[model samples]
Target: MTNMLVYFLGFLLLVFGRCRTSLGQYSSDQCSWKGSGLTHEGHTRDVEQVYLRCSQGSLEWLYPTGAIIVNLRPNTFSPAASRLSVCVKPAPESSGTNVYLDLNGWLRPLLREHEQAAGLVRCFGILEGALFIEAIPRADISRRVTAFQYELVSDELTGDRPSPAEACHLCNEDQLLLAVCTKDFVARGTVTSVREDTKENRTSINVDIHRLYRQKTQVFVPGGPRARRWSGSITMPRECALKVSDDDILFTGTLRFGEARMGCATRYGDFLRWYRRAQRLGTNPCHLDTD
Candidate 1:
C-alpha cells in the first residue's frame, strides 16, 4: 500500500507545475486564514491562495464558490523537517468542499464534503504538498462552510503506526526517553477512572496528578485540595485495554485536536528503576527528579 502511494506521488511529478489562481479578498495572520467565497461570487472557477506559517492553525471559508490552495510552511528549519506531518481535523459542521493534496497541478483526494462533516482527521507528510480545497458546485451556497484545524506533528510521537493495534503498543526504552522530552505532557498520576466511548473507539482516563513534570499545553489543571494537585484526562485507543489503577504511573503523551493522547506509560516504580540504572551508566537522555 505504501509502495502504491509512493508510486502515485512519483507519477504526480510528471505533470507538476504551478497552478494559476486569482487573488481573492481575504484576511490572514500567517498562522490562520478566514475568507468568504462570496469574494468569488461570479467567478465560479476562482482559486484563492492561502499560506500558513505556524505549527498549527485553522481555516474557515463561508459560502463556498471556488477553491483555495493552502500552503503550509512552519517557521523553522531542521534536519527532521522530512519527518514532520500535517494533520487536519474538520469541524463537525464543515460542508460543501472536497479537500485534496495538491502536488503542483496534480491532485489527490484527501477528504470529501461528507467526510468533513464526520469530523474525521487526515494526515500527510510535509513533503506531500499543499492542500487544495475546492468547493462543490451547487445552485444554493447558503449555510455552507469549509473549516478545519491543522497541526504539525512529529512522526516519532505518532509512531506512524499503520494499524490501531500497533498504535497501542508500548514504546521501547529509547522511545520512552525521547517521549519524556518531546511529549506534550508528562506527569506522575494515578488513574481515577476510565471511560469508553464506543462511538469513537477510544478510552478516556481520568487522572489525579501528583506531579506535573512538563506540559506543552494546559492539559492538566490545578485542582483538588487548595489547588495543590493537578487533574486531567488522557485519551487512548480502546484497543490498548487501559484500566483504572491505584498504582502511581508516569504518564507521557502528545496533544491532538485539543486532547491528550497516551504515548509511553510505565509504573512510577519501574521508571525510577530504569532511570536510576541509566543515570549510573551515564546514558540517561534527560534528567528527571525521580524523588
Candidate 2:
C-alpha cells in the first residue's frame, strides 16, 4: 500500500534523520505520499512476484508487528525449501544426513499447543538478517525423514500437536524402537561379559532438573590428532532414547560444534573450554510455563 510505504518512509526518517542531500535524490513518489496497503489487484500471483526477486535461498516473512524477517540461508535438508539452520552432528557422525523442519516455520504453533512459551504471539528477532519468530517448536523428531506432507485436510492444527512420543530414528522398526527404550543401551563386564539390551526393560522418570552446574571446561587445543578424549566411559549407550537416528546427533553427552567451529584454529582454545561443560538434550530442567 502507498500508505504503508509512507509509514515505512516515516519510520526510516526517524531512524536516519533527514536525507543526506537535497539534490535530485528525492523522487516524485517521495515528495508527496499517501497511505495505501500493497495493491495486487492486477497481479495474478503477487506473493510469488514480490518474493521471486529476492535471492534464491532467502525467504521473506511478514510478522504481526509490521516487521519482517528474511531467511538468509537456504533449507539445509532441501536447499529448495526455506530454513534457518541445520543442526548437524559432529565429525564421526557428521557423514550421516538428517534434517528437521525449521522451528521458525513450525515452533509457534507447537508451543502454543503445549503451552511452553506461550504469550509469544508477539515476538520477533533477526536470524541471519531475516526476521524470525523466537519460539520453540516441539521437535519430537528422531531420524530425518520427509515429514508426512500433504495439503491440510483438517482444520484442527490449532491445539497441541499429536503426541510425538514414538522414537523414529532410522526408517526401520528395530532401530526406531531401540533408539527409544534403554534396551539398546550397552556395557561390558570383564567378569560377567554380559550384553544387556535394556531396550525391552526400562523405566523412565522425567526429572525436570533445573540447574546442571557447569562442571569443568576441558580444552581440546592442538595436542595433534589426539584432541578428542572421551571420559566417563564413552561408547554408544546400550540403548538410546533418541528416536531420531538418521538425523545426525550434533552432540552426544557433550556439545559438538560443526566443522566451522572445529576449523577455527584461533578460537579452538576458547571453544574447547566451552565444549567441556556444554549442556545437552534431555528433559527440560526448568520447564518455562506457557499457560
Candidate 3:
C-alpha cells in the first residue's frame, strides 16, 4: 500500500466507532487489551491482539508465540482438528526447524539477537486438487523491522534462514520507544493474524482469526526536540503511576491507541491535526478487550 493509503486508512481507524467526541476530554475510557505477560510498563513486553470469526464449530488462535503447545506440536483439543501444536524456540539457526510443523506453514526464520525475524511466511494448501506454497514477506509492525538506523548491524536481514556464521543485528528496540514515554506506560504495536485450512468441514485458522480481534489503543512518541528533553525513551513503572508532563498537550486529549503517533505536513502541525482529530472522537469500542 502507498504510504498515504496506509496513513489514511489508519486515520479512518482512529475515527471509527465514535458518535460523540469532544476536543479536550481525557479519560482511561478508550484503551484496553488482553494476553498473559502483557503490560503497561514502559519498554517491557507488548500486547498482541488477535481475532477470528467462523461458524459455531470453528476454533481460532494458533501460531507458536500465541499458543499452548504439547510435545513441540500444537495441542489436539476439543475443536477436532486433524491436529494442532504450538511451540517457541530461541530463534533457530537452520531450516531444520520447521515452524510450519507447529502451525502448518513454511516459514524462514531470521534470527536477530534482540528480535528474531521470519522475513516471510510461505503458505501452501491443496484446494480442490491443486497445491501451492506462496511466500509472503512479514509486514506486521513488530516483525517487519529486522535492522535499525544508527545501530551496528551484525548481519543483514536475509530471508529464509539465519546464517549461523553471521552475527545478528537489529534496531535499538528502545530508540523509537523512548521517544514517546508517558509517566507510567509506553505504547506498543498491534497484531492481526489469519489462519486457514482447506477442509470445508473443519474450522480454518483464517476464518477463526476474524472473530478473535477487537481494535486496541497503543501509545508512541516520535523523535525530534521532544526526545532530547527526556532522559530516555523508556517509562519505567513507578508507584502511583509515574508522573511526567505531556508537553505536546495531545496526550491530554482522548486519543485512541494508534492515532497519536502520526506526524502532519510540517513537523509541528502533524501532531496537532492528529490530536485534534483524536480529541474529536470519544470512547473507542474496543477498550474493554484489554482486560
Candidate 4:
C-alpha cells in the first residue's frame, strides 16, 4: 500500500507540474462549486482550480475528469482562522475520484474512490492546503459524480476532536465554562439511547432534550412522545463511553460535517451547582439562562 501510494504521488506530481501553469476556473460563489468533466475530455491533463471562501460549502463534479484543486477558506479573517479545521463528507454516491490534501508539492491521501462510497467524514487543519481531487481514467464515465460537503470548524472551545483518547479527557472548570459559551449546541437532556458504530469507531448518543438552551442549524428538532420537546443524536468517540444517564445532563457540543459531536457535558444538577458557585464568585465566562 505504501509503495503504491508513493508511486501514485509521483504520478500526480508529474501531472500537476504540467498543469500548474494552466489557467483554472473559480467557483461563482464562496459556497458551492459545480462543474462537469466533459470540458477536460480532449485535454486529459487539464487541472482546474476551485476556490470556496466560505465556512461551509459543497462541491460536485459530474463525470469527473482530469483533476481539481479545491481551495477552502473561511469568508472572514479573524484570529480564529489560525484555529480553523476543515472537514469534508463525501456524498454516498461520490465515485471515480481520489481525494488528497496537497501541502505544496507533498500529497497526503484523504480518501480513495471506494472509501468515499462509505461517506465517512474526514477532517484536517486549514494549513493542510487545498484538496487535490484526481479523477480515475475510465473508458466510459456515465452517472459518475465526485461530490462532497465541506465545513470550516473553529476549535475555539473544542480543544481537540473527540477522537480515541481525546474524547475521554474530562473538561476542566475553565474549559467547561467556555464550552457552554462557545459550543454550537447546548441542552439539558436525558441519554435515551447509546449505539456503537463499529465501522466509524464512534458512538451515537440520542438525547431527549427537555430544555434546549441554544442550538445552531436546528440540530435538535421537535420530536419524541407527543412532540413536546426537542431531540437529537450526538456522536462521540466510543472510548468516551457516555452511557445512558437517568439524570438530566447538560450536553454541549459542536456540529461537524453537519453532525453534532459531543463536547463537555455533565449532570445538569452538577452543572447547576458549579454554575451557582462561579456566579457567586463572578468568575463565569458567560451568562446562561438557568431558569
Candidate 5:
C-alpha cells in the first residue's frame, strides 16, 4: 500500500510537470504573436501581422497584435506631392516600446503601384513604429533620393487611438483656431508663383500677402513691409512637397525653426470665423513677422 501511494504521488508530479511545460509553450506562442523582442532585416520587428484596409476615402493599415493602426487620407490635391497628412497615435494596451514600420521595402512599392488608386503616395516614414504620410510631388520623385525624411513627434502613448471620425477632422475650425493661438505666425496670402529650386532641393512659394493676424516679433501694418509680397522657400522636409497654384489663398504658419507651413483652407469662410475667434482669445497670436 505504501508503494502504491508513492506511485500515485509520482504520477501527480508528472502530470503537473506536463501542465507547466504546456503553459510555458502557450505563453511563448502568445508573445511570439506580439513580436516581442524579435528582429527582422535589421529592424526591431514588433508587428505580428500587417494588413491594409480601404474605405471610400481612407486607407489604413491595422496591426491587430501590435495594437497600432496607420490611416491615410485620400489625396485631394491636384498635384501628386500635395497629399493629405496622416496622424498616428498608439492604441490602448500597446507595449510601451517604440514600434518601427519599414516603408522602403513593402509600403513604398505598394503605394507606387497603386498611386492613382491610393491618391497621394508622396512619401512615408516610421515614427516610433507609427507612420506619418507626407505627399511627395512627382517632380521630387525624379530626384531619386532613396532615403525618406521622417519626424519623431512624440514618445508616450497619449490616449486612445483616434477613431475614423476623429481622423477625418483635418484643419477644422478648432484646429485653425488652435494654430492661430499657438503658432508664431498666421496669415492669409495669395500664391503668385510656385517654383522648385533644384540646387537646394526645395519648393518656394511666392505669396502676395493679404492679411496678417499673427507674427512672432514684428507687428504688421497695412501695406507695410511685413504685409508686402513675400517670396521664400520654407525649410520643410522634402517629403512635405507642397504644391501651390497661382492665386491660391493660403493660411500660413511659421514654425520656431523658421519653416513656413501651409494647409488647405477648404472652408475659407469658416476659417475666417475661427481666426476672428482666435484673435479675441488673447494677444498670443498677434505678433507678425515675415521670416
Candidate 6:
C-alpha cells in the first residue's frame, strides 16, 4: 500500500510538470503566431507576408532569426505619389554585427513615378540581420494605400557587401531644413582636404568656410581659427565609403557630435539658393506648405 501511494504521487507530479511545460510552450507559440498577421483597412489577416499598417513603425520577424531575405512592395494611390520612405537600422539590443540593406539603389525605382511595375519591387538579398524597419511618409498628400506588404525568405546570405552609414542618411528637404534650423552652425564651405587614416580607421575632412549662416557665440570668433578653416570627421564603413574632392561646395550642419556634417543638402545644386532665401525670410522654406 505504501509503495502504491508513492507511485501514485510521483505520477501526479509528472503529469503536473508536463502540463506546465506545455502551457509555457503554447504561450510562446501564440505570441509568435499573433505577430504574423497583417493589419489592413480595419481588419487583420493571418497572412504569410509581413505588413506595415502605418507610415512610421518598425517591422520585425515573427520568429527570431539570424538572417532573412525581405521582398517589399509598397502601394501608392498614384504613380506620382511620393509619400513612402523606409529606412532600416539594427535594433538597440541587436549584436554588433553590421546590418546591411541597400536603400538608395533599391528605392530609386519605386520612387520614380514612371517606372515599370516590375522595377519597383525591392528585394533585400541577405543581411547580418536587422530587428526593425523605420518608415516615414514625407509628402503631406493623403495616402490611400497606407499598408505595404513584405515577405521573409529564410535563406542565409553570405559575401554580400555591407552598406555604409551614409547610404541610410537620406533625408528630404523638410528634414534638411529642420536640421538646419536646429543645428548650432550652418555654413557653406569648400572641401580643402579629405584624409582617410587607415591605421586609425578614421576619415576626416578639412573645409574652408566661405560663409556662416549660423554659429554658437562661444565657438564663434570674428577672426578665430574656425573663421577660416574647420575640420570635421565622418563615420562611414570602409565599404561604400564617401569621397570628397577639393573645391566641392558643401552645405553642412554642425549638430552631429558638435562637428559639421554634410549630407543630401550638399548634393543639391540649388540648396544654397534655397537656404539663403530661407535665411532672408527668417523661416524654414521646407516648413512652408507652398514649398
Q: Give the poorly placed runs of model 2, Cα more than 4 Å off.
A: 1-66, 75-165, 168-229, 232-291
C-alpha-based local distance difference test score of model 2? 0.22
Error in Å for residue 194 of model 3: 31
Q: Which stretches in model 4 have alpha-carbon errors above 4 Å?
A: 1-22, 156-163
Please give the CA lDDT of all the candidate structures. Answer: 0.83, 0.22, 0.22, 0.84, 0.37, 0.37
lDDT tens string, model 2, 1-291? Answer: 999999999999765432121111121322211111122222211221111111111111111111112232321324323232222111221111122223434433211212221211111111222222221222331221111101111111122122233221222322222222222111111111223335423222111111122112332222222233221212222232223222212221221121101101112223223333232333322221112
The CA lDDT at 291 in model 1 is: 68
TM-score, model 5 to reference: 0.31
Off by over 4 Å in 5: 1-169, 197-202, 217-231, 235-250, 263-267, 273-291
**Per-residue alpha-carbon lDDT of model 3 for 81-185, expressed as tens digits?**
312211122222211112222233333332223332332222121111111111122223233111111100111111223342321222132322222332122
**Cα RMSD, model 4:** 7.8
Q: Between prediction 4 and prediction 5, which has the larger TM-score?
A: 4
**Which structure is stronger by TM-score: 3 or 5?**
5
Candidate 5 lDDT, tens digit per residue, 61-92? 22211222232223232333223232232222
**Tens digit per residue, CA lDDT, model 4, 1-291:** 999999999999887765653455666776898989897757776788888898898999999888898988777767769678888889999999999989997998999999899987788888877899999999888878999998888754323345465667888777888899999999988998899999888799888998888988888899864457888899988888578878888999988776898889988888888888999999999999998
Clashes of each: 0, 24, 28, 0, 8, 0
Report the alpha-carbon TM-score of model 6 versus the true structure: 0.32
Identify the candidate with maximal lDDT: 4
Residues 1-291, model 6: lDDT tens digits: 999999999999876544221111121322121222112221211112232333233333332222222323233333322323333322323221122243532421222212211113233332222222212222221221112223322121112222455444566655677756665556655555567757434455555555556664323334424546544443332442355654445354432223333443454345656656776887664442223
* RMSD (CA, angstroms), candidate 1: 9.3
Q: Who is ahead in lDDT, 4 or 6? A: 4
Give RMSD to native, each candidate.
Answer: 9.3, 20.9, 26.0, 7.8, 15.8, 17.1
Clashing pairs in 5: 81-136, 81-137, 99-129, 100-129, 122-136, 214-287, 215-287, 215-288
Q: What is the lDDT of residue 31 in candidate 1?
A: 79
